[model samples]
Target chain A: MKGKPFFSSVVQKLVIGITGLLLCGFVAAHLAGNLLLYSTSDRYAAFNKYATTLHDMTLLPAIEIGLLVLFVVHIGLTLRMQFQSQKARPEGYAVQKSKQGRGALAARNVMHLSGIVVLAFVLLHLADLRFGLRFNEAGLAPAQTVLQVLRDPISAMFYTVGSLLLGYHLFHGFQSSFQSLGFGGERLTRIVKIVGILFSVAIAVGFASLPIWVTLLRK
Target chain B: MSESINVTLKVWRQNGPGEAGRFETYPLENVSTHASFLEMLDILNEKLINTGKMPVAFDSDCREGICGSCGLMIDGQAHGPDRETATCQLHMRRFSDGDTITIEPWRARSFPILKDLVVDRSAFDRIIEAGGYNSINAGNAPDANAILIPKIDAEAAMDAAACIGCGACVAACKNASALLFVSAKVMHFARLPQGKPERETRVARMVAKMDEEGFGSCTNTTECEAACPKGISFSNIVSLRRESMRAQCSGRSTR
Candidate 1:
């Protein structure tokens, strides 16, 4: 990325691509960790304990730093891309309409929906995970802390719904990112589609299940 | 079914940009509903030519809808009442024999009216020239199957290239946004392996030219697709945004 203008629209997209891949990797790891909640033995308990060990002392700071960096880059890149796109057409087309074809929804609303997910989910996620678990001054035990939020049917439902929305974002976005990366070709297209579906489903199910397992199964 | 109907046509008649323009009305009887709109226009023009008057000037080449040249605003709608047919392909069955049809040229600051209904759309050509292609003018044609592109990507590129460079998109857009048009071109080239070398440059320059051409921002109203003869998808536009972002990130030089 040397000769290109530093703040060009393509650079913004590259930042988005890099940060998006990081986020996707994080989602994969988080999904794997979330599956631990289903374990019936003390292993499940131990897993939580170990997970919280660093999360309680070290991981939180590192994660907050990493997340902050990723979010800033991701969002900054998005804003720049959008600005350039707006600047691309000054006076605008005299005859403008949605392109007539198969992809009306994903084409028109992906950006708008992605924007909504970031704003609403970030606040909700911090409250649910960051503030509730790590930063709570009340010092509720991790299990009790988790249960406190999940025990409420409404809160649990909200978490589930939010996770589903996250899945929708990832569903379209995962495939879209691969397309942007120039990854798809005749040999890998089917694989990309399959991986995209699996990734979205795994993330949605893992996240959605946490609330359900805590609220419904415990009751 | 042999009923003779009378209708008045308010057609835009402008000899040149310097000349005063007005709508001229013509009365016609026994217009078959089965004829295409351009065919109907042909009937009207033929009548005028027989009367020793100059036939109304409009653009219609490759009437099958691929060339993207035939566009008109019929009764406030681009390409008449059809959902996605070109004016040349639009049938008169969309209107009653007695219906008054108002035909107007595509109106945009970028697309100047050359004469009558024929507007000079070379602005699109200039935009394409500005950076709508890959620098890989690799002189020798490479083996067709050498690139190893996924069929899906190839299909996507083909979809973007389906754009016929018709100005219907400009006519249908309220803001006169050229995002769809520019995006289609950008995405078409950006999606292919052959296009990767100059991907960043192509997007940057094309977008820059699009802005210079005075096209408006896209408000997401899908009038362009409805009026499009080829029914190019809006997905190509999204692909454009994604590619633009990716290219900007990669720091590739624009050639």
Candidate 2:
């Protein structure tokens, strides 16, 4: 088939939407696992066990590699698309107004910026617990190291803000993924939008709750 | 009561495509509130011609707004400040006296400036030529009621057919994408039984042409729909995305 390139504009957008939705799914699963921090019964024994179990899994490396591919492809396509869109209009208007409401415009425009913040926070998170960079790990449990990282005011504040920005990113992205993939019906779109808002709130509050908890009661 | 308004127009003036363009201010007096936006331009053009100056060049026909020939970026808003109204349909009553109205052409690499406030929208025509019709000869015209289409499909098809191809969607889109226009054409036929034959190849070829023309990708901001004079919904763009993918998968001819 002598067709268009595999990565045409439409196909680029299709891949981006797929990868973004997959990342959102990963974030939800990660948030669920992180809730083990609230296990105060065994002094975080369950949380530590969960961490160790995840580390010892045979498929952990493959899963991590898959996740890295998703992030790289998703973020790479977005940067290229954004740059091309800017070039599409070399000379912009002297004055321009959004027929779309100002608030909605701002939300869609800030996707890349918010995505950057979420990426940085995720890296910071990995440094603290995954790589043991924040504290000495000679005899420390993952939960204990997590507490040390969250105890630092700067780290806690960054996590809180980053989590909120993630919610902001997903608010448009969750519904946007379906549209890009051409998944729509009369009622399906409205339902996806409503659910997108709820999911965004759940993720933001769920992740931010950790730092707040460690800062306050875990002292 | 009808009234007259004195207004200043900051119109974009470009001598040629390669030449640098600038805004020239013209203070017009005694413009009738009942006059359409293009009529105000006519008054200004007459004054310029009377003074032996080159009048502004623009596109307009069927001043009643059906031909999709008139478009302008007035005061930063596509088709002026009215909702679902084309530039030709915008009346001066919406403006107050002493208002400074800015006029510019559609700014996009694909839609080049041909003259003052007039762009070369032939790129849209090229896309239409790519594969926007059913050219097959299946005999004479069939009876109107011979083809039985469901009511919902007819309404949906009509909704997609509302696109007038005025290029306002392109002008107002932040990405300067023409997906709204392209999708409208795709869905216009795809909703009815007559469009199913060329559905796969049509989307593929048109999308390739759109990319070749350097239009940006859709980000689903719904800005295009808001700018559309006919109020064409953004959902057509979504359906086009599906149609393109479907073509790549099971089409008889890829090109």
Candidate 3:
């Protein structure tokens, strides 16, 4: 991939698409694991067990590192592509109207902006829950840590907003990655689009349920 | 009787490539709703010339949509408001009396404005010259059914062939990407048997040339398809990405 710029240049767009789809897989898996928080019993038996067992794996650190690399590559490559696109048009039109009509959601035009929102949310989420920057959850089970963070009003609200925007990001990003790879037929493409919408909504709603259950409902 | 409407034209005026551009307003009265957008421009130019002022220079040929020669960013919509209509085909009835219409050239790093509403779209020509052709020997249009093409393949190729080399897709794209235009040409060939010989190299070379022309990469906003006068589907772009990937994985060079 080095020495020959053509190799790098040609695959630049492909890298973003491939990395994005991989990250979508990560998001789905993470959502599944987080749903373990809903398994409440006395002292949260199921949730605590799930957390303890997950951390006990020798492959935990390897998985974490691999996830971090995916984040860096997906985010970094897309930003570079956006900047190049900006340079492609030196001047903008005076009053452009969208022809896609209502199909052009505000999210469609601002993938980068939505991406930034998701990134900030991820950083704050890690701080509030995983790293215990906002709450001292060290030596505690992951489920307990999640509850403590979500029970905080400010943190819970942030999570709700963040999850929604992440959904918005995936709303386009989900099928867009498929389009980027050039995979489609009339029926297959339409199916992918519909499924992408469902997947995006499920991920958003699933994550937001944690905050809603912890801070608002269960309280 | 043809209903006439008065319009205020905010036309972008530039002396040359390096010259500063500004909107010069002209109030055109009694423009027939039956007149095409180019005809309105013609009326405006005539009025300007009669007043001893420099007339705005814009591109127009055949005075109809098929040539793909006339285009403008009228009110910021490529070829004006109507869907699947080029500039020459957009009628004045689309606008109301006393409406202010803004007209400008297609803006892109690869498309330099030559005058008021005319742009140097030779970039399209360059892309075509790259590898948009087949090296297979051809004497004449073969007997109608001699080649035995499948109906679906022929239809898809014809759909792609609708692209008229207009730059509206670029003007309307946020990133000024030429993927829609390039994809149309690529798909036009990819869907047919005659296009099989140089399939891999054709896409590889055209895409390389597209990048060299300083066009941006597609972000899948689908704006190009919406603005396309011929209604070229974004599926062509998807097909193009597949074609490009195949070519690259095969270790084919643009050369």
Query: After superposition, which runs of candidate 1 have C-alpha atoms over 4 Å from their true positions?
Result: A1-11, A56-60, A80-110, A133-139, B1-33, B39-67, B71-86, B92-122, B131-163, B167-204, B211-255
Residue A52, candidate 2: alpha-carbon lDDT: 86
Residue A99 shift from truth in candidate 3, angstroms: 0.7
Q: Supply candidate 3's per-residue lDDT for A6.
A: 49
Q: Which portions of model 3 show Cα errors greater than 4 Å?
A: A1-4, A7-10, A103-105, A137-139, B253-255
Angstrom error of the Cα, residue B135, model 2: value is 1.9
Estimate the Cα RMSD of every predicted model relative to the unseen true structure.
7.7, 1.8, 2.0
Candidate 3 on B1-255: residue-level lDDT in tens?
349999999999998896789999999999999999998989998999999999999998987678888889988889888899999999999899889999989999899988887899999999999889888875689898999889988898999999998899999998899999999999999888889778888998888788888888788899999899999989999898888888777876444
Report how far residue B113 has shifted in candidate 2, in Å. 0.8
lDDT of 1 by residue, B1-255 (tens): 443455688888889864667778898777787777788889999999999998999998898988988878777667776676778888766676577767778877787777778888898999999888656675677787866889988988898888889887877775566777888888887778778778888888887676667665553445566666677775665567667767656877354
Cα RMSD over interface residues, candidate 2: 1.1
| Candidate number with the higher lDDT (2 or 3) | 2
Model 1 has an lDDT value of: 0.70
